[model samples]
Target chain A: MRWKLIIDPVGRPGRDNMGLDSALLRSVQEGGPGSGGDAFLRLYRWDPSCLSFGRNEPATSRYDVEKIRALGLDTVRRPTGGRAVWHDAELTYAVAAPCHAFGSLRQTYLAIHQMLAGAFERLGVTTTLASRRSGRAPRPSAGACFALSAGGEIVVDDRKLVGSAQVRIGKAFLQHGSVLLENGQDVVSGVTMGTIPRVCATSLGEVLGRSIAFEEVARAIALEVRERWSGSWSEESRSPETIESDKFGDVSWTWRR
Target chain B: MSNIPDELRYTEEHEYVRSESDGVVTIGITDYAQGELGDIVYVDLPDVGTEVAKMDVFGTIEAVKAVSELFSPLTGEVVDINTALDGNPSLINQHPYEDGWMIKLRVQNLATIEELMSATDYAQHIGE
Candidate 1:
């Protein structure tokens, strides 16, 4: 199956990125699997450094509204379930495909993370997948995606590097993740009320002893996806601005929880 | 292996429905469903009196890794919801069939239950 690679070179607002991910998921769900409908790999960046909480996360309790307002950062709620993520100096990737492409939820997560790990390896960074420890619990109070590494997340030397989440509906699924390009963990921890465990977070710039361009990392990951999935890539012409206007930009969606 | 109660009917989506008095039925995810979901953090169910069609998404179950839509097994109106879940969403993971019951629906068509798989068939479906 040939997958469509949508590379948005321009940085967009948080709402538009979320909206585009949903649009891609809907396209696959309506098109069905193996019906000449292309799966999508979207690589994007966020402007003004937005903070996104999970669909079910209680942001009201975990974040201080006054502090968030003072920081002048954009905020939105993710359709996927997970903790909060601070999007700044990062490469955000979203993969929308037929659910059957990966048999179970866990399998789908591992598949994408593994592909990411391969891409990181190609870029000269060695990382491993986190093991699922039985009976481990998430501290919702922590209020940061990199505070803890869940099972199948990519980590370098026990420090989390990539945080991912998924939203599955009917026949299709969308899994999006954040790959930190620089050490922005302190900024994330300072804004949220909770004490984010900073020891577990790491970034590419910190690992490589120099800054990396967003385009360079995106190209490497895209190359890995092409080699791993055995598919061709093409750019999608239609903009997801319509979906942004209709859904993600709406206040109701950002604070629905 | 997950538990599959013989008295309840099941959907391929892993939702289970138990018939009640006067065309009403109780709905929740099966043991297999909850087990797969893994420590549900939140359950978003429709309020009482909302109408739903068969196979339509009625709600969502948010786990640590994913948020999955909950599909209604039969066309019906939500008559009751487990409000306790607002404070303690883990009930679904702890007791999927009993304390974790999601909602009660006044079924629109009693014959719709016939379309669901029998408990034995559901056990086979999950490879129990």
Candidate 2:
């Protein structure tokens, strides 16, 4: 198997990052089976901090609009489904591949998280994949992504360290996740009405008790993905700017729900 | 194993269709689909009177794990939507075939149902 590693050097707005992820998924789907239709692992960050809610999440009801506006943070609805996430001081990764490569949806989620856990291990941070708990469901009012760990999410000592979501388009799929690098969980919990205690989340810097560079973390994870999947890695040819205009830049798409 | 009622017809996407006498059919996700989705939190349903093409996405189902597109089983116009899902989407997890029916559509062609798989075939398709 061959894979492309897209290491975005600059931080982009929430919309462009999300748009590039979708564009990669579209490219793979259009390329069809084995016509340079290789898998992709993209690493990026959000500029100026942003709040992203799931496709079905009721934004007005869950988030405090006044507080969000005062903070000057951008808000966009994700094409994938999951709870809200505060994108700041974190390393975000998006994987676009064929559905058949990882079997079922749940299987694909676990596989990606397992590889991520391995990446954390290489960086001297131990993490585990959370399992489904047998209990009552959390309230819809719980808006924060790290408020509770869903099945196959990454956790460190039971504290959420990574949050992810997926959207499948026919034979292709895109799974994107945020790997916290610094502190921002309190801001997310405070801006939302949910009760996501700061203790419930952890970051790579917090775990290591030292600062970590985004480039270092991105390289380690990309190498781990190559080793785990036994694939050769190369830089992606196309830039994200090509698809930013009509897809992510449009207000209607960002707010479409 | 998930339930696959012999009387219902199924699509490759795991939606089941039950025909009515008035050339209409009720649609819902199969038990296997609900199991895979795991604790559904929200169901994005299409409005009544919306025309949907066969195999096209009509709406979405969001669970704790992921959001999945709901593919239409046949070409038709929606006549009714399960408004009960607005308040409680878990009906799909509790009773996918009964209380969780998604929509009722005035089908364009009855032959479309014939193109679908039977219960036994659906069972085989999901490896049940």
Candidate 3:
């Protein structure tokens, strides 16, 4: 039950985001159990929009270079599986644990996701476990990661509210997901899709019946993780050594399929 | 302490080849591959009657960890695919060597099985 969780709101720059996550994974793998003193949960965000693809996806799957340049959005690859996810108008969370520390990887994911389901339930957003059959089965909107909910994803009214992916190396697992709270079409699609294609998005505005602050969502997640795992937090940020290594910050690894 | 059963032949990519009397060879990922893959979530099994060449990508297995390509250990025609994996890919993680067996193939070249490592050699090869 011992863990160390840190919650911080990180600004954009696609390479930096990937760098932070990869560095955290490297730290836990090389640093052994309790890397950075304990298990961690980092909350972050992106600005100016970005399309991030899975680590192993071919580069051709990333973006149409001309389209991306025309749209003025950043495109990069994540060191995780799944499909392309658009980041903007959403809160992203990353949780890292020592291998086999939190039971099995499946259990840990289910536990946290179940907690999220409960939290959303409490928030009056009725949702169910988005199963793989539901996900793998063809949906009209099957092209995007966030548009379709996969097994272990949370869906409200048949639309995905959260999209997640996981990566494990040695004894470390990095699971990250995004929660939508507003229509970010302007930042995301570069143009509004009429009423923002509300089909694939559910915001706190819709859940709470009114607009909600971003901090409140982050706090709720922090409290959920803290309470579920019985952990305390600290205000320390990623070390300068890690940031300076430019390990993940490099465009090569960021864009490398 | 590893789970390389004495009866199965092995490939470097961790697929096991077991020859039956009818000249059909049952193939599946070895225990080591399943262990490294963690909990299997989805398995992309090749369709029956498809031809696959040695070292070619036959299909893929998506684990909670990552999605990895499954390589063919021999050139053969897939006579049967484990349909059970469509709903229970975790079978590979739960029983990689047996109930999780992925495909049964009509061997195009029986001699290739000889090129595969024996269980003891695979154990030694993977440093088990």
Candidate 4:
């Protein structure tokens, strides 16, 4: 009844963090296309800031290259699609497993969102799912994924807290997302004019009227995940070999748009 | 034309067309198109009153995998573009045949409709 759980606190540079994400997804996909029912959980953060765009979303659509370079933000592309996101003052996660493990894609997405929502709720922070409107009309912000609330994204008082995107290969599915616990406007400002909408984001400190330790949030997520999923938790650190050969080590892989 | 609906005309890109009372043809992407695109994320459309020629790229649908252009089935002026797609871009993924309808085209030339797919021909063409 218990699923295997991996809680990795990979705090590294933007390049390495992104690389690890890619490496983990590739390994999980190759492990068995997820049909064998095994799942892996990863928790990570970026030291320096970075910008990520989803697959099929042209990098030229939003990112302002010179400005990002000027701000020293690492730029990369993700296997998922939506819009660009600035990675800073945020903890990101990627959950990989077989498609059937979570049933349909929609169900799988909600299950994870609900897990995060529950964690936030436990902290007494009010949260809700984004209201979905149907139509081809353009939204206000076409730049950052979090700037616009789509169905299933976690939002607090009309502002996004967590924004997730997914890429499914055959039966194996890889989902990546970020949670804001601090101000990342400086990182977001590096993108371009009109790309990053001024979304009001609150950290655990702001929500509780006092500061919440980052380690505490991380521990809560790990503990809650173990309890809820009925699994034993282990903190596994990514190896240098894995980081070099697998992640952030190659620009070609990260830029695979 | 193998999988094409007989009552509905087809565009070369495989969209199905059904004529309406106002001389507009209701358009929706064929099953084959959606199946190939994978799970759709965003659906785009040209504004109303836009004129399009046959096979013109009028809109696009972004799937989890990639983005595919939605082509016009015939030369026409767009009468109405589906607005429900703003929040519900997944409609094309859920019900491409029913609620997923994309746009209404006011026939610029009724003859252009004749070039589209026939149900019988489309069925055989798509190997349905």
Number of the predicted model whose lDDT against the real structure is largest: 1
Ordered list by TM-score, greatest first: 2, 1, 3, 4
Q: In angstroms, give how far residue B49 of model 2 lies from its true place.
A: 1.2
**TM-scores across all candidates?**
0.92, 0.93, 0.65, 0.64
Clashing pairs in 2: none
- Where in model 1 is the C-alpha error above 4 Å? A32-36, A139-142, A194-199, A235-242
Write model 4 residue lDDT over A157-247, tens digit each, in one string: 7777887877665446677788877756445545656535655555556666766655666766776676565444445555223542343
True contacts kept of each: 0.59, 0.51, 0.14, 0.04
Lowest lDDT block of 10, candidate 4 chain A: A133-142
Interface RMSD of 4: 6.2
Ranking the candidates on lDDT from highest down gives: 1, 2, 3, 4
**Who is ahead in DockQ, 2 or 4?**
2
Q: Which tens-of-lDDT digit does each residue in A112-196 have in candidate 3? A: 6876776666566677886654212321112456554546668777767777777766567788877777755334333222223
Residue B46 of model 3 has an lDDT of 85
Per-candidate clashes, comma-separated: 0, 0, 1, 31
Tell me the lDDT of model 2 at B33. Answer: 91
Cα lDDT of model 2 by residue, A64-167, tens digit: 77888898878777778777788889999998888888888888999899999998898999888887876555544556778788777899888899989888
In DockQ, how does model 2 score against the reference complex? 0.61
TM-score of candidate 3 versus the correct structure, residues matched by position: 0.65
Q: Relative to the unseen true structure, what is the C-alpha lDDT of residue B34 in candidate 4, on a scale of 0 to 100?
A: 67
What is the alpha-carbon interface RMSD for each candidate? 1.8, 1.7, 6.0, 6.2
Select the stronger candidate by lDDT from 2 and 4. Answer: 2
lDDT of 3 at B26: 94
